[model samples]
Target chain A: MRYLLTIVADGMPEPEKLAVLQRECPRWVHEMDGRGVRLLGRELDPPEATTTVRVRHGETLVTDGPFAETKEFMAGLDIIECANLDDAIEVAASHPVSWYTAIEVRPFAGDLHLGEAAAAFARGDACGEPFLLVTWMGGTPATPVHDQAVADEGDGWRRDLDRRGLHVLGDALGRPDTATTVRVRDGSTLLADGPFVQGEDFIASIDVVRCQDRQEAVELAASHPVARHHAIEVRPFCNE
Target chain B: MTVKPDVRQAVDAAFRNEWGRVVATLIHRTGDWDLAEECAQEAFAEALRRWPSDGVPHRPGAWLTTVARNRAIDRLRRSERGLQLHEQIGREAMLDDITGGSTPVARAREIEDDRLRLLFTCCHPALSLECRVALTLRSVAGLSTAEIARAFLVPEATMAKRLTRSKAKITAAGIPFRVPPAHVLPERIDGVLAVLYLTFNEGYSATSGAELIRTRLCDEAIRLARALHELMADEPEVTGALALMLLHHSRRHARVGPDGELVTLEEQDRDRWDCAEIEEGQGLVEEALHESRVGPYQLQAAIAACHAGAAAIHDTDWAEIAGLYALLEDQCPSPVVRLNRAVAVAMGGDIDAGLAMVEALTSDPRLERYYLLEATRADLLRRSGALGRAQAAYARAIPLAPTDVERRFLERRLAEVRATGADESGPRPS
Candidate 1:
């Protein structure tokens, strides 16, 4: 199992404290990596530099800050490959940041990037490699005839993916009527009731697919049933 | 109420103590708050049906936990949406066993930490204050929405709505179920203390009831506070809040007389105070004060310590109490703090000065219907030889008193003033 450790802190620590933490963190990171536990780690920019974008209904909601209102922001993150939760906790607890800030440990669903999907997915393994986000966009609303075709098509695609042992995640989003848009400007949150951009077709579904390379990602995206009526955008994530 | 069997009683007790932990553990496992609560409730309901026949499990918490987790598994396997939740739990189970090699004992400890995480999440500062209080009482103290509504004197529907909104917000906003980091912990700690203190105060001084105290709520509040203190012992405010609660609770026995009349602190028998509680509270106060952060809770605890340290009313260090209240006012100034300070000043020595202070607050709208303002004014006026005005003030305050005990106490003062014919004397005799 791989675990993601989110290091949350209020603003940033003072220069001296940050310096001390920075000095100590690398040593522990090296220790974990040397022991074959650490997979990846990165320090995030300050919250002020963050831009949050949400698409609901049809409007694109963008904010200058993180989605959650909190004094403590995600200062950094680390992904560690461990045996289990107990192993994950042990690895997490050893982080020097845990002393000053909270270390949130959450297990990775699967090793999407490792391209071990065929074997692991057959075993129902949740932990794997890297994840590529496959978004199905701009599909026509289903009518009586279209509904059966869509369902039949979707089932066939699902079975094919399952047969190939491809573990994908995500659910289809509801129509624009059920959507809501939230945007923040100049520290004031402006909420528009209806879709800001109106169209018959919109983002219908999203899935995190395990793929080792661009070719594999594109192949998986092309295999989706929705690709016949909609565009599938395959974006590879830089980190877990 | 019919008498319950021993096994049933034990199950009931276990439910109160273990409900939060069970739910927290399930939430930690599945990351689904609604499902966790639902499964935990189902487990408790199952316990009720089976415990009578099974004669109660040796470890009721463990039994309920196992049953709850299994129930969650069954539900997830059967439901479409729960597929993801089920998968997460399955992965976690595998991880737990394969990685660090968790034993039963280690798992139990993890569950304990889950409760703390749940509490911190429930009391997160991001939630509204009312939402925080309702969530804390429901999630941490394991009180029903209706029960919390009754305790807080709100309608069941309002409380239910408040609780639902808060929970939805928590889920939608992705508030992690964990304690906040050090820098942010102080603000979050304050939010938690506020909820605990509100719980304690509701019990210490019932806002509206025939009785002045509700020991059950008080006990629950103290228990929750102690648990928080144990989990975060280094947090000075947690220690300070616990100390403050203990010092006030030590006087619980003497707070009311045999006739169920409110007993003024000065008139209550000092010997009746719980010495053990006072000693422990004083120790905590010293410990917290030494740390030098000096939060509002620590200041209030110091004032309580002043009263607890005194052997008698005269022995009480009114000046020190007044000084502490002043510092408290500086930190969080309010009409209530000034009112308390005035009383302490009057009890310390200068009745005339206290009366002037009380008079100054006459036009403050917030204190207009505040019974303490009227009661304090009446007391100070009676002591300063203004019987007519004192009797009128007492008359004005009696109707405002929330509890019958306070009303009776005020009526007695009115009778005392009428009988004495306006004598310039000290506080009315009990």
Candidate 2:
């Protein structure tokens, strides 16, 4: 089991103690690495460098501070793979920071990477290769005929990109009203007749584009006729 | 056929010992939790029905596993999901050997690993603490959701929903069902031990436990701990946990009065403590300490051993216990540990110092609502001949007690303090 060990400081350490911990931190990492428990680790910038973002009322809201209201803030983090929960706890307990700060050992939620989704759709083992999931966020609600014409044009463009190994998959979702949302709460499953989140604008379509970098993805995405008028978003597809 | 008494006994024992193994191995083959559980349940039912006539199998665990696997395969063969048929038939080739009634050596070794996988996955930190406890009992300990709900004091429906939601998360999120690779085993030990300890605590402290099922949780936890010990004997913390539980469990009979009220340790009957359990716990703790493995549980077991080894309250080695608690306080740093260390320090002949420590701990908001803090302070005060302050502190503590037994314990102390201070009828105006 892979656990993310988050090291948070209750308050600043004494300068002398900080100096010792700074020296000891590398030795801790090195020992863990030798034991094959520590996979990766990084020291985070202080909370002053934090930027929090949220999308409320269809507008992106950005703030310049940590997201949570706690005096204990994340100081650093290490990804350590333990055999089980007890091993994770022991690792956190032995950490040098544990003497002065708290190490919150949390296991990552099970691997839900895009590879599984690709397998579900029988995406022809294309998951191992790099691909970006580009989607249409929201724009003017076009009639079915107009959408069909655009989709047909997109098919031709997709086939052209496929010849160059840049296109992997593409699809248009049904109208937002056709979406159903499910939530289990209070020992009952509640079914609501709409998308999980209601909005005047909704995701209308998505496509997988193979690319090496975001710059190339953006350049490739900009070539589609839909990007000229409608809002198109390009995101990095998770790679195995 | 009705099950004969002896046959029923054997079946029950098999169910307790082999349910986790059967379900774990079946789930490994089937990749379906509900199917594995259902088939395991059916396999037990089959044992109850057939064992009396069939004279019980030579190896009931292997027989049950073979039965459960066959049932799972039958269900899959009947299903229309062809995509998984090739993958889910992992045990189809081994069933013939298992059915022949002679266990293969390689397959026998896999049983322990399979159970550890199930336990680790159930107690995964990604789940909420309550979810982890609930899942561990249901999946690894083989408790029914209804039984678990009643033990946890929640409605059966709520418990069912919790189990369903957790299982769905496990399936949807692709939580792998395998033991973590060997090197980080030390790192993962505490979480597994914590769930077992919490399970034991839930049963141990239920003073007015109104249900037989609720009180059985202590036995269930110890059984699981014993099972864990058999699997991970090398882990000191695991051994420490088992030792600590046994030491505390050895004193259960002496912990309550005849009227079912809580009895202070000093007032308890030492002769009533089980000697065999004490010996076992002491042996385990000694072995762990000899190995130089001093985790929190081991430290606690060592302290418990001190109390168990004392023939009388006065004979208890208070200084040694105080030292152990100090080390625990430094290592695991909790207000409860500090409170315990204060009591130990006072018992070790420093009443004033203990009182000062308890008094300073009062400003800590965490201890404000804790009744033991005031109780300990009052006890120290009473011993120091400060009757008025002792009486006042006892009165302050009585209402803060969580259970009726503790409340009455405090009230008795208050009355005793009042009897000593005849000059003042009330609390001496705080």
Deviation (Å) of B206 in candidate 1: 1.3
Predicted candidate 2 versus true structure: per-residue lDDT over B23-130, tens digit per residue: 888767666788889999999999988898888899999889878877876877686766464554544554434445445776787788889889877776545568
lDDT of each: 0.70, 0.72
Per-residue error (Å), model 2, residue A212: 21
Docking quality (DockQ) for each candidate: 0.03, 0.06
How does the DockQ of candidate 1 come out?
0.03
Cα lDDT, model 1, residue B102: 81
Per-residue error (Å), model 1, residue B407: 3.3
